[model samples]
Target: MGLVGAATGPSDGRRARVRIADVALHAITRRAARRIDHIIGDSTQARRATELLKELADLLL
Candidate 1:
């Protein structure tokens, strides 16, 4: 019992908070990319930004 208690000590609420933070960061990053795409008008920059967005999304899962 002691071992089990120690292993599972972190609460569900803490996990939820971390998940929310990741989601918020992902949204902010995408938004920034979109704004940069609008300003730069460069295909290469757009592609790199899109790749970054995909990577950030994969991290969420």
Candidate 2:
């Protein structure tokens, strides 16, 4: 989110520009998570995306 535009704006928390690869990685990972939720979260007792991601990250790392 703090990837573009003027260095001093409403979405400016960065002190330097970020690489396009980093931005693209974040966007792709975010969309993948949304896709997982869409595929597996159709039930009434489905888990939240945040919790599921954290769980997987904890296990993997």
Identify the candidate with maximal TM-score.
Answer: 1
lDDT by residue for model 1 (1-61), tens: 2212222225653343213355566777898777444565888888887899899999997
- CA displacement after TM-score superposition, residue 19 of candidate 2 (Å): 9.4
**Displacement of the residue 52 alpha carbon in candidate 1, Å:** 0.2
Measured by lDDT, the strongest candidate is 2
Cα lDDT listed for each candidate = 0.61, 0.63
**Tens-digit lDDT track of model 2 for 1-61:** 4554334344766554434456877987897776455556656436565678789999999
Give the Cα-based TM-score of candidate 2 against the true structure: 0.26
The TM-scores, one per candidate, come to: 0.38, 0.26
Candidate 2 segments whose C-alpha is farther than 4 A from its true place:
1-20, 36-61
Model 1 clashing residue pairs (backbone)? none
Q: Mark the regions of model 1 whose C-alpha exceeds 4 Å error after superposition.
A: 1-37
